[model samples]
Target: MDKPKRRNTETDPWSGLKMYTAARIALGRTGTSVPLKESFAFKMAHAHARDAVYSSLNLEVLLQGLHAFNLPVHVLHSMASDRMEYLQRPDLGRMLNQASSEQLKEEGSSSTEIAFVLADGLSATAVNEHAIPLLQLLVPALRQAGFTLAPLTVAEQARVAIADEIGELLHAKLSIIMIGERPGLSSPDSLGVYFTYAPKPGLTDEARNCISNIRPEGLPYSLAAEKILYLIQEAMRKKLTGVKLKDGIGLLQG
Candidate 1:
């Protein structure tokens, strides 16, 4: 009987497609199992995803970076006391703690047209990396459009819905939260933005619009800003978001 022929990855039919994407497409096999290199690469990607999930955001560094925007910034915390509790009790992560609530106390209703919130969601790595770069583009465009902006709020152990309460407290008609999205094996640092009109406590996910994958490699900062700004303008005009609203690429041009 002839010896079993060895497989060479270079000759694999799918190998040519590897250059087009970061996805796992052409991993060659060793007999019936994945090759050692592919298996090791997958494990490393998995480790990165786990690390991103458990990572902590450096508040001081983040705050410093945000200071360039020349807006008042506050650090807030969710009802969850720690990462463990945040993971175990997701509901707690969606609400503000007593002190955080007090911090927003004096903001009267309709103080601003929009409030921007940054939260260390499932992937702090994402917030720490992409949040500011995206904001750099977004804030200026919003200002030029004559939108009144509220102070920036950065929260810890937070979930997506926490922005609703923050926006409510800040008395903003619209609330935008830039959060770290759940990490995938290939995307350990994907950022997501959720915006809602008439933000208030107890609002559901259906009341918001999301712009996701704001990392440089995923959705470039400029493009993300464009999409977000378009949503903001339309939401302001239409006075709604979520399922009821739709994306319109036709942004007004000068």
Candidate 2:
């Protein structure tokens, strides 16, 4: 019997296409099957995605990292007590536990211009790695923009909506939730920022603006910070965000 022909990946017409993006594309073949190396790579990517989802945020590391910014920080938890419950009950993840709410209330009712919430969303790996660095950039920028910041809030088992609850409890005019985005095969450690102006409980998704795919290999830190700062500036001037307010990419040109 003749052996099957293996397509030389180096000479495959489609191999060069991979240079354009991180997407899985242009895989070479062996006879009628995908190349063994490609199959192994796919499985590896899948493992990373799964691991990102189940990973727990290192609370001590996160807290210590936040302290480096010299800002007051508070820890909070969602009603969903565990990762299993967080995944199974998203609604619970979007609300603070009773203790967390009271803790925010005790901190005072002053209306801060912005509140930052670091949340362990779908990809804890993303949050654990990227949140502090992003916050380091964002906090200083917001201060320079004349926005008063609330004490930093670190939330566990949290969803984007949890930022609204924290903002409302802290009497903040805006809420920025830095969370781990849903991991994709090629991008397991992507973080996301969801900004909501005039955040309050029960506000719908249409009331927020999101900047996603924030990682070293995805959206670089400086660009992400610029975009976020742009949104915050626009949100303040327009007194709104979400569907009505556009990203104003053109504003970046000048």
Candidate 3:
């Protein structure tokens, strides 16, 4: 018998470009509906995104990793009380609990160049996976620049702004927070960094500069560190962040 002809569905024109990214693209369709494989893959991605949102920070692992940095580490909480409250009452997550506030005031250093904060935000899995690695690369650069660093603060059930209070209490000139970014179907475990000069309570988003999508598959640790270091140096030199401090990497580099 002659070899049988195999059946093939219509292939997307962009199928060749699919290899360049993890984005959903070029899924070959079967008849009037999406192929079962693509549908299932989408469902799986959605599940991963959802799981990232609900995940808890593994503090023990985080603390152990932080200790190697040799800075006094303080674990704090937002007024949200729990994950549910943190999600529902965003205002509460912007401030620290009473005891946590007092502790920072008492133990935190005075007038440091920068304060590093790690917060478990929308996706704790992101922080658990990427925060330390980024910090490990950036911290040494800060130290070499003769900048004084405040104690490392780790906050659970927290949001980005809570670092403002931490930096203010510590009397830090600048605050850089590494937080878990909200999950997306294609990027469930993305870490984000927010750098603010002259941080204080009640400051809005415009007062800070954000470096987002930090991950091995996205922005790798070394490049992220380089950008952060540049931002910090520029922010310190210019006494500002936010929209004013543009990222001038190679252009400004001598």
Off by over 4 Å in 1: 1-10, 107-110, 250-254
| Residues 1-254, model 3: lDDT tens digits | 98888766455578999889988888877888789999999999999998998898899999999999999999999999888888899999999999999988789376788999999899999999999888888888889989999999999888999989999999999999999999999999999999989999999999999999999989999999999998999999999999999998978765
How does residue 157 of candidate 1 score in lDDT?
98
TM-score of 2: 0.93
> What residue pairs are clashing in model 3?
none
Task: Score every model by TM-score.
Answer: 0.92, 0.93, 0.94
Model 2: colliding residue pairs: none
- Give all candidates' CA lDDT scores: 0.91, 0.90, 0.91
TM-score of 1: 0.92
Flag the better candidate by TM-score, 1 or 2: 2
Better of 1 and 3 by TM-score: 3
- Which regions of candidate 2 are displaced past 4 Å? 1-10
Question: Residue-wise lDDT of candidate 1 within 39-112, one digit each (tens)?
Answer: 99999999999999899998888999889989889899999999999999999999999999998885444579
Off by over 4 Å in 3: 1-9
lDDT (10s digit) by residue, model 2, range 1-254: 99999876568676788898999777867899889999999999999999999988899999999998776899999999899999999999999999999898899867788888998899989998898888889888888888898889999999999999999988888899999999999999999999999999999999999999999999998889999999998898899989998987766696
